[model samples]
Target: MSTSFSNLSELVTAVKAATDAILTTEPKEVKRIRTGGLPVGTNNQYFTTWDFVNGMIRDHSTCTWYSLLNTFEDERFSLDQCCALVHRFDYTFSNFLRYSGFQEMAVLAAALTKHLPTAKTREEAVKAVRTFLAYLNRLAAWLFHYFPWNIGKHLTYSYTTASIPTPADPDLSRRVHVADGRKVRLTWQPLGICVVATLATKENPELCEDVLRELPFSIIQDHAVVSGESMYAWAPVVSTAPVHVKERQCDAPVGRIRYSQATGNKIIVQYGRVTEDIETPILGEILLQYRDRLGEVGSAVWKSTFETKQIILLTIETVD
Candidate 1:
């Protein structure tokens, strides 16, 4: 005449409420225990008191309480005996405060539930209990990471291939070798340039254009030196000019450019290529050098090449 157990959802809700209540209320008790410190309080009392309380609550909510509810019809345990049994375990609850003690108690709690009166057979009960314990452990790990208290402790970041670009000049043939061993080339130009632009999910197309248009030519010239080549393994050199988007009807270049998401979320002054050579001392013994004449110059560039391309400043945010 074993009693039927509650549905999974109802049981989970009850367990959550009970555990929440115990955890939320224990802060005051913890404060009191801490304040009671030193010789009189002793290391043993300091550790044991709180440990036992938490262990009892966890064990009861997840196991003992559920067992009692389901086994109410079992004649081996009277209602009063069940109540006494719960009380008897209270003294051992503090053992959980010690190293690995809580884990041991959790194991015992699983054992208590494994042999519930309603269990069809011993093997079935053990398997069910093991599965339940595994589920609880997984849930605990998830909650530990997701809870507000653990917010910044274990932060996660994500990136997508489509949003990032390789360091290549739109005017030059851009070749990229993928991790899976494939190389692709992108030929394009800068649509516009901006000193600083906000990067967000929502951006104004016109604003992006205006920012690029307002960028000084000097900045573009400065970035041109480093813009077309990779400085480090993953560094992205900004292009000096906006990359052109091909028109559907005609192959005419649309005034649009693209950008790669910054690596390591850092910024630096970059160089881009210029059609004209600036006045600078030529390196000695360098072959194929041009002086007092205008020719194609190469450097890193940091600005939008097109109205559609965004020159965004980077920022970090946390998500639950």
Candidate 2:
């Protein structure tokens, strides 16, 4: 476990594995830990670093990740570095540069491979894993901000009021912290939808639909509790990009946002209003998206406004 990773390829592999392991877990192993089956520690509460990592990799539950709350606190330096880089570069970074939609992940991975040197010690290796994980998360948030039309997190269902979007469903039990701190308890209820997009002509539209299958749509809800208070913000509105005509005689449209469908009504704009119980509180929006299956919510670049302040401009989609 102390071996140094020699090349950037190995580092990339580690980074990919770390990300792929985000929502994965093993319940049997976690049970073993909790029941004191492991020789190392009494239970998860007394878990060592290895035990903690195993629990996360195995069961990977919110409870397990909650255990990492202390890990992040203890490694505040690395956490801060990760946050600063995202805030300074990823979030506030210039839109002057961008990779094509499909190449986003590749470009993100490429950046780390630059300043990242091969690890010589276990500490260095641990730092690299944390830093790269942070980088992946930060990039994920930025993608939501930069590409609202093409990307948004999955929403289990649209909620117009303070009430939870989905009822007390156990399946919607997964939760994770978003990138932007706002220092709140941010939870994204990930949900997905599917739409069919094809370039076939009207005569062959059905054929094209059959050929390509329905495209995947992910819409994450910005519903969460911040600092022990129920906070809410309106879901972002996404509209079809303006279709412009190159020539006056040509009636075709141009400059419209791409993607034909969306989840909620654009005019209504009532996804995240506070519940009837409260009047005022700090809230966040700007949910995250992942390439995961529809029922699973992906990561995102969520936002929160402080005490009646304004919020960011973003949008989520619904199927046509």
Best by TM-score: 2
The candidate that wins on lDDT is 2
Which stretches of model 1 miss by more than 4 angstroms?
1-27, 34-53, 73-320
- lDDT per residue (tens digit) for residues 1-320 in model 2: 11345564566566555444431222233334334554553454434523343322222212222123223334554644443343233321212112212123334434443434344443554454344543233233222222222212343347544545422322212221112321111223321232121122232233223212422222223223221122222222111222221111011111101111121111111122222221111112222231122122212223332221122323223224
lDDT of 1 by residue, 112-143 (tens): 43233344444433333333333332222222
| Each prediction's number of clashing residue pairs | 40, 30
